[model samples]
Target: MRILVTGGAGFIGSALVRRLIAHTDHEVLVYDKLTYAGVLSSLEPVASSNRYSFVQADVCDAEAVAKALREFKPDVVAHLAAESHVDRSIDGPGEFIQTNMVGTFVMLNQALGYWRGLDEAAKARFRFHHISTDEVFGSLGEEGFFTETTPYDPRSPYSASKAGSDHLVRAWGHTYGLPVLVTNCSNNYGPYHFPEKLIPLIIIRALNGEPLPVYGDGSNVRDWLFVDDHARALQAVFETGTPGETYNVGGNAERKNIEVVTAICSILDRLRPKAEGKYADQITYVTDRPGHDHRYAIDASKIRADLGWTPSVTFEEGIERTVVWYLENQAWWQAILDARYATQRLGVA
Candidate 1:
């Protein structure tokens, strides 16, 4: 199948693109806006392949989206573009609303038109897979997990915008008879992750002998899905999932925020030990961001049962691999720090 992946230059999107190019027979076209988070170098592995192509454009631009649809003529439109950082969302929400909410609307409208023009077989084969977050279900207490039937209670600007987009996708499917699939996934971490996120930030800062910042009490819990595993789950969903259905993808590995940070420290201490002390010594707690969710966990049984997709990497294995990747590929992240963000704190509001 020919797939057009929006936001394919970003972390998870790029991972999906690489997976498609390397592991599958599908041709790929990446449509990205090159936002600060979108790094072209992430696609370096598959850029040389004749089956891999890229178009630098925004999902909010209807004409550009339509042009890509018309030219690429993709069998699947995997929508992954959005402003995804929670802290950044707290700092500035307008961008999230515009990109995550309005951008999805534009994509759906264009996709609906494109699907309408296709023949019966082509239309039947087409899919608009909306990739989303488990945060859309808001915070969990301690025991229960978020299922496909969980009610949305988005607390942050980022999750709220994503929740709106998810609703829009389902609306398109229900109202227009468009073939749409939605997947709400847990937190993703792995190779080529933007440095601003927790795992990468801790790794980069710890490597530089800088303080590793933890928010509030550092007890916030999150389910950690490896990006490569997530890319695989995406493939499973779009390739075989039922249209108008939602799948919850997870790593089945839960850890507190402090645990996540210290785990990174442990890995670094083993691989690149400090001369005198442990990397965990640099850990410091700071004020938490506004409307911070206490916990998020996904009930991935539906996906596992229906599509036979499960996370292939455990937290320990995935984290160690991630730390090693950063250590060996300093040039990749150093270029990012040199050009854009410097691992500073955000979302102070």
Candidate 2:
């Protein structure tokens, strides 16, 4: 199959594109806006393949997206482009609303137009897979997990915009008979992750001998999904998932924010230990972001039962590999830090 992956240069998107190009016989055309988070280096592994191609364009640009759709004539449109950072969203929400909400509306409409022009067989086979976060379900108490039937209670602008996009995708499917599949996933962390996120930030700051900032006593919990695992689950859904249905993908590994930081520290201690003290010693508490969700856990039973998909790595194994990837690929992340982000704090209220 020929696949057109939006935001394919970003972390998870690139991981998906790389997986498709490396493991399958599919042709992939990566459509990306080259946003600050969309690093071309992330796609370096598969960029040389003839089956892999890239187009620099924003999902919000209907004209450009339509042209790509018409030219690529992809069997699947995997939409992953958006302003994804919660802290960044808290700092400036307009971009998130414009890209996550309005951009999705544009993509859905353009995809509808493209699908309408296709033949019966083509239309029947085409799929639009919208990738989303579990944060749309808002904070969970202690016990329950977020299922596909869970009500959306987005608290941050980031999650709210994503919630809006998810609604637009389902609405397009329900109202227009478009083939759409939505997946709400837990937090993703692994190779080529943008440095601003928790795991990478902790790794980078700890390596620099700088203070590792933890928000609000660092008790906030999140389900951690490896990016490679997420890429596989995405492929599974687009390939075999039922249209107009939602799948919740998770790693089943829940860790407190402090636990996540300290785990990174422990891995660094083994892989690249400092001379005197441990990396965990640098952890410092800071004010939390506004509207911060307390916990987010995904009940991935549906995906496992329906799609026969499950995460391949535990958080312990995933984090160790992630730290090793960063250590060995210093040039990859260093270039990003030197160019775009300076490893500073953001989203302060």
Candidate 3:
């Protein structure tokens, strides 16, 4: 299969590209905009492979998307491009709406046009898989988990835009008979993660001997999924999942925000201890971001039962590996800090 992965230079997308190049015979073409979150170095491992190729372009450009589809002639169009930071969304939502909502519309329209031109057999084999977040279900109380049947109650600009895109994908499938697959996944963390997210932010700040900010007492809960595990789930879904179906992928590991931060501290303490005090000592509570969700957990039973997909690593094990990666690959992250972001707070609105 020739797979065209949008946002393949970003963290999770790059992980998927690497997996495809290293494990499968599928050729890959990466279409990305080189956004602040998109790091070309993330694809370094598989860039040398003859099966891997890249294009620096925005998903919002209809002509570019159409051209990629016409040229690459992919069997699967895995759509992962979007503005994905919650805090950044709170700060500026227009980008999210444009990229997540309008960009999806562009992708669908181009894909639909391209699909129409294909022969019957090629049309039958093609698929448009939209990758999404469980945040579309909004916040959960304490007990229940989000299932495929859960109603969307997106609270943040980021989630609202994603929810809109999910709807667009389903509409394209239901109304036009487009072969589409949707997957809503839990939180993803692991190697090559941008420094702005919680785990990596805590790790970098802790290493810099700076305060690690925790929002609103740090009790918000999230289900953690390893990036590689997510990449595998994606492959399984596109390869075998039925069109017009939605799968919820999760690591099944839940932890409080404070717990996540402290877990990173514990791993750092064991791997790279501070001279005098522990990394946890730097943790400081700050004002929570507006519309912060209390909890998000996924009922991954459907994906596990239907696709035989499960996370490969526990939260503890994944975090340890993540910490070790940051420790050993200072140059990778240092280049990011030097070039683009400096681990500052965002989404103050």
Candidate with maximal lDDT: 1
> What TM-score would each prediction reach against the true structure?
0.97, 0.97, 0.97
* Residue pairs with backbone overlap in model 1: none
lDDT by residue (185-240, candidate 2, tens digit) is 99999999999999999999999999999999899999999999999999999999
- Number of clashes recorded per candidate: 0, 0, 0
Give the alpha carbon lDDT tens digit for every residue of 206-265 in model 1: 999999999999999999999999999999999999999999999999999999999999
C-alpha RMSD of candidate 3: 2.4
lDDT values for all models: 0.96, 0.94, 0.95
**Candidate 3 residue spans exceeding 4 A from truth:** 341-349
How well does candidate 3 score on lDDT at residue 346?
A: 46
- Per-residue lDDT for 150 in model 3? 99
lDDT order of candidates, top first: 1, 3, 2
**Poorly placed runs, candidate 1 (over 4 Å):** 341-349
Candidate 2's C-alpha lDDT? Answer: 0.94
Q: How many backbone clashes does candidate 3 have?
A: 0
lDDT digits (tens) for residues 1-349 of candidate 3 = 9999999999899999999999999999999999888999999999799999999999999999999999999999999999999999999899999999999999999999999999999999999999999999999999999999999999999999999999999999999999999999999999999999999999999999999999998989999999999999999999999999999998899999999999999888888889999999999999998989999999999999999998989998899999999999999999998776344444321
Clashing pairs for model 3 are: none
